[model samples]
Target: MTWFREGEELDDEDIVSKVDYTTSKLLIRKASLSDVGTYTCKFESEDGHKVEAEFVLYIYKGPSFHDTTIYHEFLEGADGVVLCMVTGQPAVDVQWLKDKEPIPSTHRSQLTIRSVVRADYGEYVCTAKNKIAESSATFMLHVFEPPEVFISGDQHSVNVGERVAVSCNVTGYPQPDLHWLNKQNGQELDMAGRIHVLDGLLEIKDVIPADGGLYSCMAVSTSGNASRDVSIHTQPGPPHYLTVTPGPTSVLFTLKTFPINGGTPIKSFVLQWRKNAIEKWEETIVAASDVLAITDLRPYTKYTVRMAALNNVGRGQFSIENTVRTEGKREPDSPAISTDQAKVEGNSFSVPLEQSDNGGSPLLHLNVKYKEEAEKSEWHKMQLPSDAKSVNLKDLTFGSDYHLEVEAVNSNGSSIPATFNFTVPEQPVSSRMTKGTVAGIVMLIFLVVFLAVDATCCYRNRCGLLMAVAGKLSRWKDPGLKKVEEGEGTTNGDVTLKAISKPRRSIQQSGVQTISKEAGHLTEVTCDKAPLTKNEKLHPTTDA
Candidate 1:
């Protein structure tokens, strides 16, 4: 090596050159500016010096790729996006692939897919590469969609004897294939037995109640499989009714004919009548011929009837029962009686007897009677006041008991007597003195008249005897003392003022008691009369 000095050179020691070669060591070190120099020297040996070339060094960084992200969950038929950003001193290229195939270029087909679906489900790999570095990441895709189905008629309710149609409808993309299966079993059902398919619809014609059940429609596709379930419901049949010809006796009914559910043609019927009110049943079997007559049926009764239909699917739901009732009967009754006041006075009563017909004849006879004391009285014969069937009795005593008896007489016979009794109250009276004084006066006048007549008769008879004696003495005596003429002093009874004959006395006053066999027993009747005043005429005892 040669040295080139830039600073001041020293003396002989600094400029000294090596004249001896060492055989034991070699010196090698990192180059520095201190080692840089240019120097010239003469060789001691011939043809041994050689020359070498100079060199320089330079450095730079490269690109890198990391931080991959997919902003959506992997799902079938759904689009997904993946991002893997690259960072480096140099830029890199970016691209996308599905199933290891680059996407095609078209109006709908692009590397960035829209509305991705099940076919796109797979491992999605993303890669980045540059002059310096390269990287890759992967994501899984899942595809799925549930199934949908429907029925043709969509009917859930149906009556017996009514025809029905059932069908299943299914729809899906990718051309889904459909089939039918029973809910009770996983086995597939045959297309036979009233079951058929049109297009994609599975149909069951004339579906009966037995045909009602849970059915499943299964749809299969390249992507997945789906199924739907449906329920079939039915209603009870129409009503069965029973009617009675003759009604019941007491609001209880007995049907004449058997109950009939009109849904089916009747062969024979069982007549069952139940009291829905009481839950009691009376049952009988009747044929079509005997349906007209129902013996011993009671009127006005309530009943319920039921009918059932039988077939291979077993007896269907019973028909709705009907309730009926019987009619009512008539009753027998009797007549009634009432009365009105005929005549009434103070403390006295006069009643007109009127007889009204009540389930009987008109010519009814009534017996009239009076009694001071009821125990001693007998019926009296008094003519009725009128010719009419009704009668009135007058002059009844006050404060006296009266009884009346009416006998209902018909052409056939007389009925028991109907009796009525009543009493009339007496009128109150005052003045006790006049009743006795009048009796005394009546007695005194009778006594005084009788004595005067007796005195006159005695004087006439004595005078006659004196005159006879004078006559006889005068005839005997010489000196005859002749009687004075008696005619001169005699009083003429006929010429005198007409003397009133003593009035005939009442039998009550005469002290005579008489009785008649035919006479009704005398009843002591007390009449309350007005007090006898001076001008009032006394009641005559006997007509003279």
Candidate 2:
């Protein structure tokens, strides 16, 4: 057995061959391109007869790259190309991958991008394969973008001793460095002063008029630098929002505020007033922040008021004049009264007292005026004390409509009159109670005559209507006085009273003595011994 190259026998000791009864085998270790050729195997019988077979051995190699890993850089929106240099015996098939994900490619061993974005950055693989083996190459793509800047506000207006801030936003692939500059001079602003930059913002504290200028904000990066500008202005304006209140003797001036003071602080104000257009002007200087009061003014007068503010730049223009009139001596307000407050009694109007305003002066008196509504007559007038509690008008004509007016007077004037209207109710007919009184008097006279006759009959004959009533009443006397001893009463002109230990009322430790009244005599007798004999005269016992 033999292995051959280009029909020449291979004699390297590393090649081994083995012959068996029906087959021949050859083994080669670490074969190379140089060993690619035609090879033959020989077989012989026991006789001198020979058979030969041949084969063409072609050596194959897998793909390889010049660089295993590479880095590529591109700006945004630019094209990018990565090439894989490979060597192999057979043709190689190529495929592309981005971040470990497959990407279809038209060219073998090459990857192309028409437009690159930030998403295109990161690891990329170029895979190649042949009949023998597969290999890959790696590329790291980086996309860059230039810096762009955006400022917040275009302009600003500030007051004196105020704080102001301006901000800007920057965008770029890599973070940008920010700077604030004075646009008037291309110099960077100080970082350790009242005006400085913090976190992409430009700030100014304790602002002055000089601080008003064009400011620039810049952002810098490896790709590019970007800038934007802003402007600030300062100016002083006139005072605003003035109000005036008038009283009887004075005028109050209210100066609300001034909005734009430029960059100067206001210290004071000057107020000028005139009694009228013909009179000379009087001016007073007051500290800032005041509700000024000018007193001692004559009542019922008109005046013109104007004011100006004082700042570092001097006084500004005067505000428009405000015309005000002081109040005159005024009549008191109307008293709170209603028709219901003046109640209507029979044939009269009862007006309940309610104190009214006295026009800010001591009250002189309260005057009441009244009249019938349907009659063309002069009103009846009445006067009452200032503190009177009520007003009553009586003897008013029934079924007549009436009107009443009430007012309070002071030294200044009379207050407004409060009026009420009501109608007097009609008088009713004589009542049944009067008739009942006449009937009751006639019955009383007849009862008195009957009582006189009954008394005369009882005195003369010892029996009459009143005598029967007396007997019946005596039988029903209080049982507690019943008896020391019980005795029967006689029908003839005698009354036998029992002398008992019990008295008419329940009193303790008491004795009883009997007293009987006869036809012409009252006698005291002892009933404890025995009952009196019928018609027997019992002598009066003075000591009994």
Candidate 3:
């Protein structure tokens, strides 16, 4: 077998090839793009048949980068782009590299930075690779920015004839320039002689009323300019014509403030006072007015007072001192007293009193006195604390009238006595007597009802009860009496009589017989002789 390049025969040592004559197969190794061309193949059999064909061969290579290096420039916050174009047969894969490290694969030819910063200024590489070969491109990015400026201090005040210095601060890539200006007149301040400007500081010597206006410190940079204003003030003079007035527990001071504020308005007034001239002074801040009231002071005290005026710069000198005395302690007013009903039990009573109006001073004690109205007894006194509103009186006589007086006392003096009149009520009747009377009446009524019921029972039963009683009485009297038969007889001297039984049944045939009392004789009676019963006859046995 043989190979050709550009229509020239190639030697076996210069190319690698494999051929199989039985299978009619051919294979090539280590092929490159230069091997892309047309080739011819011929085969002949022993039977005298032959075949001939020509075909074109194409070789695929890996990606090739169009540019080896790239450059890009942008501000800190601007966007940046870098191109990594490549060409090769059979599509290749592309990726980005940052600082010699492989980045994520995007299959894109361009690398874009959405917002660039200082951290983004570094080496970047774009790589394209395929199965066979790989290529890369490099780029360097630069980011730049302008300067930023700011001022430091603001609104400072200095006293009159005092030296003052104001400073400013700046920050940026490039250092900024700083200067001082008079904001009121829109004029630049001279930095020579008495006024000097060094670095970021501005110094002013011998401040006066003319220099009390607004002054500004300005900072200039490539980016922009920034400024801050400072307000200066010259102190005013002290207040004058101080007057003091004393109250019960406080003091009032009136003063005349300076008409000209000495280049600055008075912000406030200070009033100083003390209990004694040698003690530390207590101060009270007051508005820009003529009068000041200081409270929470001790009563009945003497104090020394002074005044001063204050502005934005500083406090002025104090005025002349004056002495005044507070009002003295006063006594309490008369106390009003009220009383509840007197509770009287037997010979004891309790009276409750309520008192009000302790005046300005706190009450220390109270005095209670009482006397009997009827007998004009000596007054009894009791002492109690000021907080006590009720008093209990013991061992008092019952059914008696009392006159009570209460007085309140404080540190200063006692008030007018408050008087009240109450009576120790009479002893009430005992409940035992009423209960006994009710019991007696109930017993009497019960006895009467018993008697009436007994009578009713007797009437309902007729005279049987009485008759039985009589029979019993008779039996008691004649215990020998016995029941007689029909033929029974009693023997006497020729006076024989038959005894009868059940006299009530034989009363129809029975007769009553009588013997003459003058003759003193006895008689025998029978049923045949007397046919009428004694109960049937209305007439008496003896002739009337």
Candidate 4:
């Protein structure tokens, strides 16, 4: 290996061969400057002979830094348009990444964003790269808010002579401009007179019918524009009341007329009503000043009434309807009363009474009376409940008999009393007894029989038990009997026999009493002669 100076590789000499080389040809490979500075070649013979050669190589330099340029400051909402220009030693491949995601190149694919919104503000990168090096440029995108409109006050319903105001509210990066327009005019409103534009509000003062129109507010921004529209109307006045005076089938209705406060005088009035059960309306036309008198109406019928006023523009909306019925002067005919057996509810007798009339007249009053007997002097008259169809005999005593009658009354006069009779009698008292008493009595009889049978069986059983206990003692082994004590508190050897002795003596005493009675001998067993143990243990007889 050998070291060479600057420009030395261009003048370096070729290697010389030895003269004893015997005219042998030497092979030298061409080396360019790219293979610079150091090189070594050595040959070794079989007997340790050696040969050597050295060379240097160098190359020229090219451009280093890239001229990839990026464009900036795009207007917001301009479809995200952008430009990237690049210059490099070797033309590099250009690629785009938005938020770290590769962007595909298609016809719609440009550096532009579609439907750009506030959330679309972010960093976008353009990369120029090759096998050796890579570089990227980041452009920060900014999205401005679009413009919009806002209404000032709620304008659903506005009264006449009252002011209504509307406004346009907007926002943008460059602060949007507001405009007002009457869509009916199709032109921009330069100033406010009828419709005043101050700040963002379009105020309509002392609103009149003529002030009604389509109002629009528009907002323009560098990003976009927005608009909204609302309609205005003049409100009607408070309503008037109409009165109807009666004639046969016709009635005259008088309206309390008044001029519209903030409006023109009414020109015409419309009167409408409907007959009972009728679906369609009957209209009457009259001068706005004239009172309405409808003719040929149904007698004694209900009618729903309504009216409206008209001016030069059109009809003001109708007033709320007030219902009225025609008058028929006929008096109510006598109401016939029909009566039946009445149920006596406490202090009252409820009776079904029916009365009917073609004309609508309420029964004003009724009266009732009763007779104690067929020979009673006169009907016992009592004014009945005003609404009662029946009368009650509150003062009558139980088991008493009485006949009842009722009379109907209206505005004209009372009807003849209709008579119906019923005999009031004492209610049966047996109904007061409860089933529990009979059940208790039956259960008592059954219990007595059951106890008598059980006692007799228990008596017979006692005799057998006593005999068994005696037999067991008599058959006891001597070893078991030895357990008995001998003296004082001990049971004596005669205790069993003595306990058994009384029962046998009782049988004998009963035999003596029976024998005495059969033989016609009146023999009394004296207390002194009675067996002491038997008398003590048997019934334990007492002096009483």
Q: Count the backbone clashes (under 3 Å) in each candidate.
A: 18, 1, 0, 5
Poorest 10 consecutive residues of model 4 by lDDT? 511-520
Prediction RMSDs, each to the true structure: 35.3, 19.9, 19.5, 19.1
Cα lDDT computed for each candidate against the true fold: 0.45, 0.71, 0.66, 0.57
Question: In angstroms, what RMSD does candidate 1 have relative to the true structure?
Answer: 35.3
- Give lDDT tens digits, candidate 2, residues 66-177: 8544988888788888787777767788888877778864547567888888788899888888999999888888988778889889888776568889998888788888
- Candidate 4 per-residue lDDT, tens place, 69-179, comes to 344444455566766654443455677787988778822213767767666667788777655577667767776776767776434345567787776676665578988
Candidate 1 residue-wise lDDT at 532: 42
TM-score ranking of the models? 2, 3, 4, 1
lDDT of 3 at 446: 100
* lDDT of each residue in 1-544, candidate 1, tens digit only: 3322333322334423222233311122443334444433222335676653332221222434456454334444566555555554345444456688654441111135567665665666555555767555565655444345666554344444455445666655555778877664455666666755556555556655545556677888765687776655443222235333333332122333333232233344344566665767665544544333333445566656554433222334544566666444322111111235535466445554544442112233333444454676666655332124443555666678777654544332444554556676665554333868778988889877765665454344322333345445644552211221223433222222221133334222322211111122221111113344553346643333
Q: Give the TM-score of candidate 4.
A: 0.30
Q: Which stretches of candidate 4 lie over 4 Å from their true place?
A: 1-83, 87-115, 119-146, 152-155, 172-174, 186-194, 221-225, 236-544
Quick one: ranking by lDDT, best first?
2, 3, 4, 1
Error of 4 at 337 (Å): 65
State which candidate has the highest lDDT.
2
lDDT of 1 at 28: 22
Model 1, runs deviating above 4 Å: 1-74, 77-91, 97-142, 156-179, 182-188, 195-200, 220-226, 231-305, 308-544
